[model samples]
Target: MSRICKPYAAIRTFLLLLCGWVPLLTALGAAGQTRIYDIRYGNNAIGTLETKQETTGSTRRITLKSRVQMKLLSRMEVDIFAEYRHNVLHAAKATRLQGKSSADSKETSTEKSANGYTVIRKGERSILHHARITYCVSDLYFTEPREIRQVYSETLGVLLPLKLAADKRYELTMPDGKRSYYRYEKGKLKEVEISHALGKAFFTAREGA
Candidate 1:
């Protein structure tokens, strides 16, 4: 009877090791190559959220964290974490034409990185493709009207509200047409009053919170 119990116990222990420990170990291995996020700026915002994202490299994997400071009219500062993800490869490898990128951090009056980003192995230390980074955003760019909001929308893959509708999701009728949709609030179309080069481009939210 004791021998029979021993085999069952061994089987249970083996299951525990396989189910519990292996994934944790793989995650630990992936950890070394993941992205790290931070709000590098925004404590003293000028007119709007003036934050930046940054990462430090070691050896295993690529890391990243997207942070923002919702600065409005040079008054309030709402520090927030927006989005993040990771693979073996870092952003540099995900969108770069040649050397390392400076788009993630180092705040200045200078323009955004045109080098693009990539997504390959952190161990590989290089990128494969080229995707341009956001170049510029105007004042009231975070929240404003449509005509002015198009710049921000374009960066986020949205079309102007005029040629496009705010009640449903569809492709942009603009030159850069793709599967775009109108975002919603509490069953009402939320409005984004932005400041853009073309005056004001209002992107209203749709019906649904």
Candidate 2:
């Protein structure tokens, strides 16, 4: 009878520990905020874009992922990741893959250095002469840049010009002489129109929030 009681007591103790951790585990899982966008070409749905942000103490992590069907047989995907500590850039990386081939992939990485920032692309390294970078292209998806004059492009490894257009929308000029327009409603990003040489693509908020 004593042995039976001991086993029952151990079972109760294990259940108590499990109950204590359930809420903490749920909170940890819910630590990030995610927003989804539907990528469209004209009236056709081509792909989806998802962005997530998570913050722990003073460090913040932001990630963006998207897959687009460029043509009947051509598929392209993009993944971008950035980390910031105390509102300053720590490191960022971007990768672009064509179709299902890794040989047709391109990657760009940027890291914070004591002097400024180091950008690596195509196995070559270059220095960016900046004291600090507080805002980047990824931040534009979550935060409306009404007063921001310039923003860092993690993919291009350079700064791009941001300006308010005559129509009250924000436009960012890319390195390839193409301009992307961002439209915000109620201080939140609602839609983005990106122009390509072949056509245009739009990213509309899925939840409309």
Candidate 3:
């Protein structure tokens, strides 16, 4: 996967929780907010990600869209939509397209059930029980900055330990030995730093954009 795809994968998994699990935590105010971010690899402007959230009655919806142009020939795009009702995820959908002509594409859809959550990807079905699942991608402390010791990663589909520093930053080490750092300000995610073998990639919020 490309560097841009890594964060999108994680975000896609978290959208599942946002659609289904965020309501269980706290109620967001009626006001809606949107943020635009620039994804950079070293000094190159590679892509942009736009995130928006809105609330109506007891339902909350979040949408994210990103497009990246890599090198001179390859391009990738991702779109995610999530909906929640009374703190329970109602439905969510994500689609990813790669290549100049979008020759390769994959999509995943999730729905909440009375028993648990159902996820469909590439024609495979899986049941995720609330009890069996200990954490979610939301626990990374981006939206929820409360103290958390571990997080469930939807990309890797596994539980990983998280280290929180005194400055309110959270760090996680990927399976491939790469480390990613997350920072938030005023309870909103501000930046993400991803370190890979090549170098560090920074995703920073573009204020007023």
Per-residue lDDT for 1-209 in model 2, tens only? 55433332222211111000011222244348688888776677877778787778667777888766634446667788888776688898888776688998888888999879999977899999998887888777677676688788777778878899999889877665667788988766788877654456678998755
Strongest candidate by lDDT: 2
Considering every candidate listed, which one attains the maximal TM-score? Answer: 2
TM-score: the better of candidates 2 and 3 = 2
Q: How well is each residue in 23-142 modelled by candidate 1, as lDDT tens digits?
A: 123333433222121211213311221222222233222111222222231112122221212212112211111113443222111111245332222223233233432211211112
Model 2 compared with the native: what TM-score? 0.81
- Per-model RMSD to reference: 22.2, 18.6, 4.6
Regions of candidate 3 where Cα sits further than 4 Å from its true position: 1-26, 100-103, 131-144, 149-163, 172-178
lDDT of 1: 0.24
Model 3 lDDT-worst window of ten: 12-21
lDDT of 1 at 194: 27
lDDT-based ranking, best first? 2, 3, 1
| Superposed model 2: Cα runs more than 4 Å off | 1-31, 196-199
In TM-score terms, candidate 3 sits at 0.75
